[model samples]
Target: MRCDQVRQTLEESGEAYPAPVLHHLRHCPECAAYEHHWRWVRAGLLALARETAPEPSLGFARRLIRRLEEGFLPMRLVGEFFETAGRRVVYFTLLLATVLLLAIALPSSGPLRGRPARDVSWPQPEIVATRDYPIPPSELPGAGFSLTSESDVSGGQK
Candidate 1:
């Protein structure tokens, strides 16, 4: 390990003998020296006291309220309101509108919702079977023949 890494480990762990890294350091003279020096230097780094922080001002609350009243919230914090409000309204409105539009536009094909249609059955036309009048070759027009009125057949002869 480098000198700085050993120093950091010594400072963070605050131990004379590091079981994990000491094995690697003992084999390496540079690292072992770094660990030895860091252990001594760690004394200075560990000298910090809980009393070092300055006392809070008596008027801290009053000052904080004044700052709040002045609309001095951080830019990122100020943006949170607009961001959350826009997301709620836009997403909610879009979903609501989509649901309403779909309800109005879609076909309700269920038996209860759909209207009943008139019964209709389109059947294939059949060849007229009659023993009295035999179908002649001349009477055949096409694949599906349309029969003329009986009066028309007789009127043409008259």
Candidate 2:
């Protein structure tokens, strides 16, 4: 069997796999050799002491902690949120415009309460009725109509 096939079986629990996999490993020379080396390396790592430590350069931990603390302030977080949200606000404004257009295009069955509603003129008199000011066909001396008194024209009628 190939090392890939054997490595997969080694990674999974034996109870989750078929028994023939283990039997094949025992008979396959290459798989048996790979499994033997893998077990030896795993044992070496497990046998190490728990207290083993790696040495650190001077001020490395303190400088890393300082960098993390300086970069994660609340103001920086709020600024980043606005930067990410600005595009969404533009899209929301576009959606609101579309909604307004549709609202105007569709008619409603209520009082015209919306702004810029249609303006209707009041029911004014169409046919003016004035009597006794007789109309004349010709400006004759003795006529069907005549002015009783001469009135000045400037601001005169009122």
Candidate 3:
């Protein structure tokens, strides 16, 4: 058998070589060296897997559990609600509904409110005219029309 066939057999069987592959290994020095190297690698990996992993100290799990249980309940609820897609969508929908209700319920108080806002008269009326008096001199400069009261200007002295 070829070296490749022997190598394939060695990898497939893990530490056990078939009798025919072993006969091939006895004749081929290169295949024998390769098999020995792969066997050492497998043994090292097996030993590493069997080694003990590190563990936390005695009360770590208890302390962590107690801390979680005693922490803020509202914050924990919010955290859990945001942890998944469906929960987050529900939370967002609830939040949107709350905002929408508040918007509808609260009375709006600004110039943009429901009732049409009355336009504020600019430059107050008194500045333009008095009850029945002539317009201000500063306002009407040269319209030559003069208002004469029947008591004063019917027949002028000057």
Candidate 4:
């Protein structure tokens, strides 16, 4: 059998080595070394399991519980609230202040506000009395046009 198969069998069988695994370990020095390492690990683990764990001092559990309870004071609850919701409140306040600052810093005559009334007056056209062309006033470009009836422009058609 292959070294991997033999090692897998040895691991699965725990302390019991099958005939094939024993034969493989006897021939393969690499597998024998692997088995030796695992034996040492198992022995150490068994020794740990057999040894007794150290006991805590008297009132250790009570002291730990008392300390845990003391940690949950009203001030601690307030601190937890500040840790969570306080950040959001501060951010919202900062955002509102920023918006207010922008509103105050911006010009009052922005597009949102109505345009200011301009005190500008258009220049009146001056009439020239030059004798260059003696054209009649009735023959002016816009003189023939008036607010006439629509029927007059439509050839009197109804």
- For all predicted structures, in order, the TM-scores are 0.33, 0.29, 0.35, 0.40
**Model 3: per-residue Cα lDDT over 15-89, one tens digit each:** 777999989999999999999999999899999999999999899889878878888356767777667767778
Checking candidate 2 for backbone clashes, the offending pairs are none
Per-residue C-alpha lDDT of model 4 across residues 18-126, encoded as one tens digit per residue? 9989988988999999999999998899899999989999998998799788884567788998888988999999999999998898787756666655524444333
How far out, in Å, is residue 36 in model 4? 2.2
Where is the poorest 10-residue window by lDDT in model 1?
118-127
Considering TM-score, where higher is better, how would the candidates rank from best to worst? Answer: 4, 3, 1, 2
Candidate scoring better on TM-score of 2 and 4: 4
Q: Evaluate model 1: give its TM-score.
A: 0.33
Report the C-alpha lDDT of model 1 over 2-114, residue by residue, as the tens digit. 65666577667757657757766767787778777866765666675423878789999999899889978878876998899989999999999999998898776555456
Cα lDDT tens digits, model 2, 125-150, are: 33222323432334334565555334
The Cα local distance difference test for each model comes to: 0.69, 0.65, 0.76, 0.77
Best-fitting candidate, scored by TM-score:
4
Q: Which portions of model 2 miss their true places by more than 4 Å?
A: 1-3, 12-18, 49-51, 54-158
Question: Model 4 scores what on Cα lDDT?
Answer: 0.77
Error of 1 at 37 (Å): 2.6
